[model samples]
Target: MTSQGHVNNVIYNRLAESGRVNWTRNLAQFSDPKYQQEWFDLMSPKSIGLILASIRTDFKFPMTFPDRVTVLHKLVTKPDYSSDRFYLEAVMYSEQQRRPAAKCFEDIVVYDYRAAKKAPLKPFMVDELQATYDLQEQRKEEAEKKVAELQTFVQQVEDSAGAA
Candidate 1:
């Protein structure tokens, strides 16, 4: 929060991080036992871990206090699943405002904690990512329908406010 009573820009990164962390945990938790163990081991502090290589946030609007915020993340397709690094895109949605407040893009790398160097992403990890991407693709149609509805509603509100 800032003196202006809105969330400071840096906080948006934390919101996106929360979404990415929870998504990874859920992905591991819901996967097959073998894959789950592999993912957990990869994320374990003693073993290889995922690290953020870069992040960029585009602010759409400022969110005021007392707003319920929801963060949603989807896998980004680039560099192929065999690559050591991958990307994710997240949107911060403000329920009170009924619109997105910011968009975040993250570049994540596989790293060997003990070796202190980059590591290749395992096959199981790539499979999980591919599955995740497929799921996102499946959901795109529903998301588009909802987005259209929201856009119509937003326009109505804007026109009414202007008339007032």
Candidate 2:
């Protein structure tokens, strides 16, 4: 079984290799300076325990090295009702093809490593994650709208050409 930490590490490495420093940098900025040594300290080994309850991955297309890809990670479930459990969805988009190459849906549980049991997520952290998800949804909607508009324009052009 792949651990959540392992998956996170893989994504981090891929983003770094793709020269997407901004995405990683934005995530790192989530840590509060007063409590954390660094931005990643929020998920640091000493602070939090994350278990990968389940994961489903689907590949829409073959991915190759050196292909610029953008991975968008979003919180798929609200943690307010069940603070110990949540879902995150990651979509890897191929820039060259302008489409999604792969996607992963992960169910994660917050754990108490010291107690060896499940733990409730902090309210603040949950709020931040929800906000991030909202932003992602907004962006996705805008992109879809743009694509629809472009498709309509192309169809109009094709009809005019056919008539001529």
Candidate 3:
């Protein structure tokens, strides 16, 4: 937060970073043990890891402290992506405001730690991304309905807090 009570822009960057890491970790939940180990190796030594080639954030609404944020991530490509790199799109939802606060796009590469260079996407990794993406697509419709419900709930809570 700044002196003027606006959230510092830097905070949004960190939010995106945190969201992406969680997104990677959540991949384990949707896939088999082999896929789980792949994600684990991504963060470990002498293995493959994600390298951000570029990132862009579009701010939609203002958010303040004591607010709840839910950042959702999904691959930009469908299950058949066969590139050395891919993009992920994210929506940073401000629960307090009951709307999307920001949208983020990340261009990521698979980098080999030992080789110190970009690597081709492994089969397991591609499957993992696809699995998570497919599940997210299904949940997106359900979430849209819930988001409408949450708007009223969130507004009520905010109104109640202010009345205190």
Give TM-scores for every candidate, taking all chains together and pairing residue i with residue i: 0.79, 0.65, 0.76
Error of 2 at 52 (Å): 1.5
Ranking by TM-score: 1, 3, 2
Off by over 4 Å in 3: 79-81, 136-164
> What are the Cα lDDT values of the candidates?
0.85, 0.64, 0.82
Instruction: Report how far residue 8 has shifted in candidate 3, in Å.
Output: 1.0
Q: Candidate 1 vs candidate 3: which has greater TM-score?
A: 1
Model 2 bad stretches (over 4 Å)? 1-25, 30-32, 35-39, 59-72, 92-102
Off by over 4 Å in 1: 41-44, 78-81, 141-164
TM-score computed on alpha carbons, candidate 1? 0.79
Among all windows of 10 consecutive residues in model 1, the one with the lowest summed lDDT is: 37-46
What lDDT does candidate 2 reach at residue 49?
Answer: 53
Residue 116 lDDT in candidate 3: 84
RMSD of each: 6.0, 6.7, 8.0
lDDT of 2: 0.64
